[model samples]
Target: MNVTIVGGGVAGTLTANYLATRLRDEVRRKEIEITLISDRDKLLYEPGLLYLIFNRLEEKDILRDLKILLDPGVKFVFKRADKIDLENREIRLGDEKLSYDYLVIATGSRIVPEEIPGLTKTGHWFYNLDGAVRLRDEIAKFKGGKIVVSVMGVPHKCPVAPIEVTFLLHDFLKIHGIRKSSEIIYTYPINRVFLMESVSELVQNLFTEKGIETRTFFNPIEVDAEKREVLTLEGERERFDLLISIPPHKGSKVIIDSGISDDGWVPTDRYTLKVKGHDNAFAIGDTTDLPVSKAGSVAHFQAEVVAENISAEIKGLPPTARYFGKAMCFIETSFNEATYIWFDYETQPKFVKPNKFTHWMKIAYNRMFWLTARGVL
Candidate 1:
C-alpha cells in the first residue's frame, strides 16, 4: 500500500521516518512505499532563525535537502499540492494526480498580511525565511525608535516567538548603544502573556523589570503607516517608529478548499492526530487543530502517534498509540540566558530555571534540527 504525505515539514518528515524505521518493521515486515510531496526540495530549520539574525548561524546551515532527508524506501515528490480528494484517494499536484491508500496533511499555516490593513505594505513580518532575512536587514539599519512587536491573531506557530523577538530586540538595541533611546512595546489580545498563569506572570515580571511596556487585550484594528500609529479595537492609539507585526494566519487554501479543514485548520482527533470525518487521513504539525502549543516538539510527539496508528492499520490491528499533548519550549530571554517550559493538556506550564545549560540546549537544538530534517532523528 502507498502512503502519500503532503508537505515536507517537521510533521510530514517525522511521521514518514518513524513509520519506516520502527512501525513498518514491527507490522508490515515489508517496505511500504512512502512518498512526501511539497513545493520545495529543502526543509527549513526555523527555530534557529533567531540566532541567524545575530550572525550566530549561517543561512546555508539552516536548511537540509529533502532528497537526502527521506529514507531509501521513501520517494520524494517536490511539487505544490493542488488539492486532496478524500473520496477518490488522490492528491492533485497541478496537472498530475498521485493515488494514495493513506494521506498525511502537514501543509502548515499561511500568513495573510492583507487581513491587517497597511500591514503588508507598511509593517514587517518575520515568520518565514525570506521575511526573516528582510527583517534582519531592516533591523540592522534601525538605530533607535519605538519598536513595536506583536502577534496579529491566535493559533500562530510558536506563540512565544513574538516575546522572544521583543527580548532579542532589547539585546540588539543595547549592542547598538540605543537601549535607553529605544522604546519597546509588546501588545497582544491574550489576557495573559502566555497560556499558563505562572509562565505569564514570569514573563510579565521580566518585561516590567526590563522596562518594556506590555499591553494585553489590545487587538490591533488598523495601522496608520504614515503617522506611525496603531489603532486598537478598544479606542486606544499607540505610535511606533518601527512596526513589527505578525500578520493573521490561516490554513492553506488547498486544505480548506479540499474540505479537510474547518475555519482554516484541519480538524483532527486531538489524541490520534486523525483527521475528523475521514478515516484514512491524518494531519500533524502546525496544520492540525491540536489543543497543545504548535511547536516542533509537539509535532515530533504527534508524529510518533500518527506513525503507530498508520502501521497498526496495515497490520489489521487496533491503533494503540496515543498523543499526550506534550510540548516544551525554550524562551530566549537574552543571548546569555534562556528559560524552558514543559506542559500538556492536563497540566499548566511550569517554568524551568534558566542557566548556562539551558542556553546550551538551545545551541544543541540547532544540530537536532539538522538531523531531524535529514530524517535521522
Candidate 2:
C-alpha cells in the first residue's frame, strides 16, 4: 500500500516522522510505502518568524530542509501540486502525476495582500519568512513614525502573533530611544482584543500599562501607498510610517476548485481528521477548518491522530484514536519575559506567569529546529 502526503509544513513533516518511527513495525509488517510532495524543499519554522522579524534570528537558523527529515522508505517529491484528481485518486503536479491509496492534503493558507487595495504595494507583513525579513529591514530604517500593527480578518494563523508583534514593537522603540516619537497602535476586527475574554482582558491591560493605543471594531478598507495613509470603513484616516498588516488569509484555491473544501478549507471529522464525503482522503493542520487556533501545536496534535488511524486502517482495524482540540502557545511579552497559555475545548485557558524557565524553554525549542531538520526530533 502507498500513502501520499501533500505539504511540508509542521503538519506534514511531524506526521512523516511519527509514521516512519513509531509505526515502523506496522510499515514493515504491512509493506506500506509513504510519499510526501511539496513545492519547497524546506519546512519553515513559523514560531521563530517573530525573532526573524526583529532581526534577532537569521533565516538560515530557522529553515529546516525537508530532505534531511524524510525516511529512506518515504520518497519526497519536490514540486507544486496543480490539481487533486479525486476521481482517479491521483494528484497532478505540472507534467507529473502521482497516484496514492490514501491522500492527505496539508497545503496551508497564504496571505493575499492584493485582496485589499494598495496593501501589497504599501503594507508590511510579518506572518511568513519573506514578510518577516521585509518587515525587519523596513523597521530598521524607520525614523520614528506611526507604526500601526493591524489585522485584516479572522481565521488567521497563530492568532496571538499580531499581539506579540505589538508588544515587541513597544520594546523595540524603547530600546532604540524613540519611544516618545514613535506611536504604536494595534487594531483588530474582533469585538474582543483576543478570542477569549480572560486573555483579552490581560492583553488590554498590558496595552494600557504600556501606553499603546488600541482600536477595536475597525476594518481596514484600503491603503494609500502614495500618501502613507490607511483608510478604514468609518472614514478614519491614520498616517503611518510603516503599516504592519496581516493580509486576508484564505485556503488553497485547489481545495476549493476540487470541491473538497467549503470557502477554501476542508471540513473534516474533527475527531478523526478525515475529510468529509471521502473515506480515503484525510486533512491535517491549517487546511482543516477546525475550531482551534491554526497554529503548529494544533497541527502536530492532529497529525498524531491521523498517523495512528492510518496505521489501524492499514491493518484492517478500526481507527481507535480520537483528536481533542488542544492548543498552547508561549506568548512572548518581551525579550526578558513570556507567558505560556494552555487550553482545550472543555477547559478555559490557564495563563502561566512569566519566568526564565519559559524563556529557556523557548530557546531550547528553537534549538530543536536543527534536530528536526535532520529528522532527529
Candidate 3:
C-alpha cells in the first residue's frame, strides 16, 4: 500500500516515522511504503527562531535535511505538492502524480505580511527562518527606538511567540545599554493579552513589572514605514520607531488552492484529528483549524494520534487513539531562565517557575526533537 504524507514538517515527519515502525514490521515491510512530499529539503526547527533573533544560533544549527531525517522505510519526494485530486485519490505534481491508499495533509501554514498594507517595508517578522535571520540582523542595528512587537491576527503559529519576542527585546536592549532610550511595546488584536485569562493576567502583570507598554484590540490595517506608525482598522494609531510585527498567517497555499480549506485552514475534528468529509484522509499540525495553538508541540501531539489511526486503518481496524489538544512549551524569559507550561483541553496551563533548569530542559528538548525525527527518541 502506498501511504502518502503531504508535508515534510514536524507533523508529516513524525507520522511517517510512526508508520514505519508499525506497518514496516519485518513481515509486512514489503507490503507498505511511506512516501513524504515536500518542497524543502530541510526541516527548520521553529522554536529556535527566537534564539536566532538574538544572533545566538546559526541557521544550520536548527535545520535538518530531509535526507538525514527520514527513515529507510519512507521515500521522500522533494518537490512541490501541486494538487490533491480527491476524486481519484491522487496527489499531483508538475509531471508526476502519486496515488495513495491513505493520505495525510500536514502541509502547514504560511505568513502573509503582504496582506496588510506597507507591512513588508515597515516590520521584521521572526516566524520563518528567512524572516528570523533578517530580524536578527535588523535587531542588531537598532539604535534605541520604540520597538513595537505586534500581532496581526489570532490562530498564528506558536501563539506565545510575540510575547516571547517582547520579553527578549527587553533583555536584548538592556544588554546593548539602550533600554533607557528604547521602549518595548506590545499589541494584539484582542482585548485579552492571551488566549487564557489566568495566563494573560499573569503575563500582563509581568509586562507591567518590566515596564513594557501594552496596547490591546489593535489589528493592523496599514503600516506607515516613513512615519513609523501602525494604523488599526479601529482608526487607532500606534507609533513605533522599530516594528517587529507578526503578520497574518494562513494555511499552506496548496491546501487552500485545493479547496480543502475553510479560509486557509483545514477544518478537523478537535479530538480525532480527522479531516471532515473524508474517509481515508486525516490532518494534523498547523494545517488544521483545531482551535489549539499552532505550535510544534501541538503538531507532535496530533501526529501521535494520526499515526495510531493510520496504523488501525492499514490493518482494517477502527481508530482507537484520540487527541486531547495537549500542548506544552518552554517560555524563554531570558538567557538564563525559561518556564515550561503543560496543558490540555480539560486542564488549565500549569507552569514551572522560570529557572536555569527549565532553560536546559528546553535545549535538551531541541536536541531530542532531531533524534525523534529519526525515530530514535
Worst 10 residues of 1 by lDDT: 22-31
* Most lDDT-accurate candidate: 3
lDDT ranking from best to worst?
Answer: 3, 2, 1
Against the true structure, candidate 1 reaches a TM-score of 0.95
lDDT for each residue of candidate 1 in 235-348, tens digit (9 for 90 to 100): 878898888887788877888888776656888888878788788999888888777777888888888888888878887889998888889899988878889888887877
Residue 35, candidate 3: alpha-carbon lDDT: 91
TM-score of each: 0.95, 0.95, 0.97
Worst 10 residues of 2 by lDDT: 368-377
lDDT of 3 by residue, 1-377 (tens): 77899999988998888888777782154777789999998998898898888987788879989888888788889999998876689899988988998888999988999998999997889999888888888899989978889999887999887888888789888899999998988998999788888678868977898799998988999999898899999888888888898899989888877888656688788887777877788888899987788988888888888888888877889988999989987787777778878888888987766789998888788678898776666
Inter-residue clash pairs, candidate 2: none
lDDT for each residue of candidate 2 in 134-168, tens digit (9 for 90 to 100): 88999888889799998988888998889888988
**True-structure RMSD, every candidate:** 1.9, 1.8, 1.4
Off by over 4 Å in 1: 23-31
Residue 266, candidate 2: Cα error in Å is 0.8
The alpha-carbon lDDT assigned to residue 75 of candidate 1 equals 75
lDDT, each prediction: 0.82, 0.83, 0.85
TM accuracy, model 2: 0.95
